[model samples]
Target: MAGLLQRVKSKMAIFAHRKARGMLDGEYGSVFRGRSLDFDDLRAYVPGDEVRDIDWKASARHGSPLIKRYVAVRRQTVLLVTDTGRNMAAEARSGEVKKDIAVLALGVLGYLAHRHGDLVGLVCGDSAATRSLPAKGGEAHLERLLKHVDSHANLEAAASRIQDQLHHVARNVKGRHLLFVVADEIAADAATGQLLRRLRAQHEILWLTVRDAELAPSRQAGTDPIARGDSFSVADSTFLAWQPATSAAVQAAYTKATAERDAARKAMLRGAGITEGEVAGSADVITGLFALLERHRRAG
Candidate 1:
């Protein structure tokens, strides 16, 4: 147990290091720079154009008109709501868990938001709304938020009532802010859609569903029974077991169900005029977030 805990901690540290470096390097585009006010390029300074923007040297060299281009100014607030519910504890085929993946995703986003000088805030919800960290600026604020998230065992309880939490968040946050939700694919439902619509009316929302490879269809079959050692309780001294054939069938059904849920979730997001995506534990969350951020910047 101690060894596994250490490994998890080490993995988290490494992920954080890589993520922090990526944000610092600004490899994911310059959206974090907030829109620029100064002209970046100068085409031909058209007639009636602002004379102040004329590039005299370029005009002399080209023997034609030239104008200075300035950067646009765009600033936004980002809010991250992470569902630390019981379902997020499922273990992926590679031994990675959904809750761990959620933390990594949240950490990366927090780091990126802080680096970009955006106000960063977190709303963690489970069976009920647990913690609400109002959007704030500074690395210190992000650190505090991350620490609060890391200290809690979100999966210790039963499935989370995300819809209720969303309603609560909507009531408290009443502005145009970027909202990112991280959760397992299984928990998204009809209520989630309703809440999404209400929230989208006031904010830019993005949904990221984390999944495990074992949950996929291709790897759902095998001869051995799916079993794991008893850790939650000592009442049973033997490993829990289920026939591979049965397990495979069950997994297939789950996969189908999850797919349907994902489709529904996507449609709801689309209806809300929001963008969404899924990230597997085996995949790179950093890359996923970078793509989302770029898309959001372009849309802006």
Candidate 2:
């Protein structure tokens, strides 16, 4: 099989054509608020650039906003958190396997951390158990992390409970770290919200949600084969979709429920001060992440 990290690099190479590679790196770097006393240089202030970095005198003299850049004095750790339950083994909105998209997202971020000279670790598992890999450097270790996620998440795995993984981080992990979480659409709850707030206080967090498959037909006629046939829930094999269920009223109701659910999820994350992005498939992973990082940089 082709190496997973290599696939991530290939996708990034394709994306580099549209945008400078450094832009992605810069966006990722800006997520961390930590700065060094050593000055690097000054650059024109972007929308998401921290206002604290602005040099008032320099801006006045230059007649424009400019941010003071600094050389990073410490190597930061990025912990990739994900759900490896059977739910991830289901299909995404783009008809690709959700776990594949998850792996791609994780690999891209891991590679960026590798390039930035930061340690990369992983925390992923199903409801049965949560697992962690010690933070370390190197592409080989990252490759191993990706491989572990790809191989373990399958149809037979246990159900997903992202809260469990978050609890693990809250209880066991120490020190400030950048947490990049990738998982499916998680239902919002009081306990989950409280846990997120606690974690947000301790670590910088960015979220990527893998979109679930469309059960109702979109405007594009007959494009979704999965929707045309009977759909089964990955968690319990419960029937989710069928031809009769695609009636206009049913679609309308489904649409309403989906919207409300998404809104609640967004609200929960925003309340916890976490920036979120969504990807329907592997194709959108790079762009989705770029937007996510940019949002994180802009977020208060």
Candidate 3:
């Protein structure tokens, strides 16, 4: 099989064509505002680069926008947090496996962190256990992190409780770092909200929610492919299928409930001052991350 980081780079190459080249790097770098006065060098400014970093005199002399690079006192650490559980083996909104989407999302961000000269680490597991890897540089280390997430997440894994991983990070990891979380559509609750707030206090966080598949199909979408086949729940033995003959009232109720639940999840993350993004499939991971990083930079 092709390496995961290589797939990430391939997606980036496609994204680079759509947007300006190196725009992802510029956007990713702009999020962390802390920088030392020790000047390293100057380079051409990309579209997403912060305006404050533009050297006016240098730009005038060089005849284009230029951004100043600084020699950092310490390298930043990016913690890739995710869930490895049966839930991830289920279908996504795009009719693809949630675990595949999660890997793409994680790989994209981790690759960006690697390109930024930052150390990348991973914290992923199910409710039964959580695991952590030390932060380190290099593409080989990043590939190992991605492979771990890809290999461990399956239908046979334990149930997902993303809070466990967050708690592990809160208790064991020290120092401020960038925590990038990719997980399923988690329900909102008081305990999880409290834990998120606590984690937010110690680290800058970015959340990517892998969109889950719809449980029921609406009457109008009766001819959809998903509606033709049966669906099984990973959380339990209960099986559900998209019924074309389902009542409009039931569809409306499900729509309303889903909207409310999503609102609550967004509010919970917002309350903790963390930026959140959503990806329905692997195809949109790059665009979704670009939007996520842009929003994070704006929030900061």
TM-score of each: 0.66, 0.83, 0.82
User: Candidate 1 on 217-252: residue-level lDDT in tens?
Assistant: 223445543423222211223333344324777778
Q: Between which residue pairs do clashes occur in model 1?
A: 36-71, 38-70, 38-71, 39-69, 39-70, 40-69, 41-69, 42-67
Winning model by TM-score: 2
Q: Give the distance in Å from residue 268's predicted Cα in candidate 1 to where it truly belongs.
A: 1.9
Candidate 3: pairs in clash: none
lDDT of residue 30 for candidate 2: 79
RMSD of each: 9.1, 7.3, 8.5
Residues 60-158 of candidate 2: C-alpha lDDT, one tens digit per residue: 999999999988657888999999999999989999999999999999999999988999999999999999999999999999999999998999999
**lDDT on C-alpha atoms for all candidate structures:** 0.64, 0.89, 0.87
Q: Regarding lDDT, does 1 or 2 come out ahead?
A: 2
Instruction: In candidate 2, list every pair of residues with a backbone clash.
Output: none
- Compared with the true structure, the alpha-carbon lDDT of candidate 1 equals 0.64
User: How far off is model 1, as Cα RMSD?
Assistant: 9.1
